[model samples]
Target: MRCAHCHEDNDLGLKPPPPKLQGVMRKGKMPSRAVATDQSVAQTVLAGKGKMPSFAGRFTEEQMRALIAYLRTDMPLPQQ
Candidate 1:
């Protein structure tokens, strides 16, 4: 939850609130993006878009996969 905590924290006062991750993969697009694929989602996470900060150089491929997996689950994300 290290990386994801920020995405979930509503109290961060982020200029544009982060989008909740649940079902984002199923929806098949990144938030506020018109044309995005799973690869594109990964790219966005790595590169950032708009107000969301880039995660580039922070996550290993395995970690990124796990994060994506967690976001894909139909079940509620576990509290950290």
Candidate 2:
């Protein structure tokens, strides 16, 4: 959630709030018009969605794993 586009507070009125990850993961809805999975979330991060920027080459697989794991735990993103 370090990315400005992913963090709602940082984005402000720039675009729609990035969907709530916990609910999206649990319910399979939001960011996209369909249900979400770890793989899909990773894809969204890598490819970008809506106003969110793409992180395609910015993170390693391990980093993506860490990010998904963190979201599944429903923990708040740490402050920079």
Candidate 3:
């Protein structure tokens, strides 16, 4: 599989790390942490958030869906 952001060839079996935490917190409020779930990753790729570039025009929705499905099967989540 290729990196959605860089287009560099990445092993489909390799699991990507979660996105870094962002946003400010009020007093006694917990920090906002965003995970790298399959859905989030697809949205990020489609919307191009942060360091991720959008794949909206580059790939068709069906292609994106296939990629997501492949990733889900090839890259299992790490043990907590």
TM-score of 1: 0.76
Per-residue CA lDDT of model 3 for 1-80, tens digit only, reads: 33532333332333464332221111212122445565665666687765455667877778878766655454432222
Q: Candidate 1: what lDDT?
A: 0.71
lDDT of 1 by residue, 1-80 (tens): 65446667655677676777677767776567544455777788898878778889999999888777776774555567
- Enumerate clash totals for all models, in the order shown: 0, 2, 0
lDDT per residue (tens digit) for residues 1-80 in model 2? 46534573555665555655554555666456755778888888898877778888999999999888877776656655
Candidate number achieving the greatest lDDT relative to the actual structure: 1
Give the C-alpha miss distance for residue 57 in model 3, angstroms: 1.2
Off by over 4 Å in 2: 4-6, 11-13
The candidate with the higher lDDT, 1 or 2, is 1
Per-residue error for 39 in candidate 2, Å, reads: 1.0
Candidates 1 and 3: which is better by lDDT? Answer: 1
Taking all chains together, each candidate's TM-score versus the true structure is 0.76, 0.74, 0.46
Q: Lowest lDDT 10-mer window, candidate 2?
A: 1-10
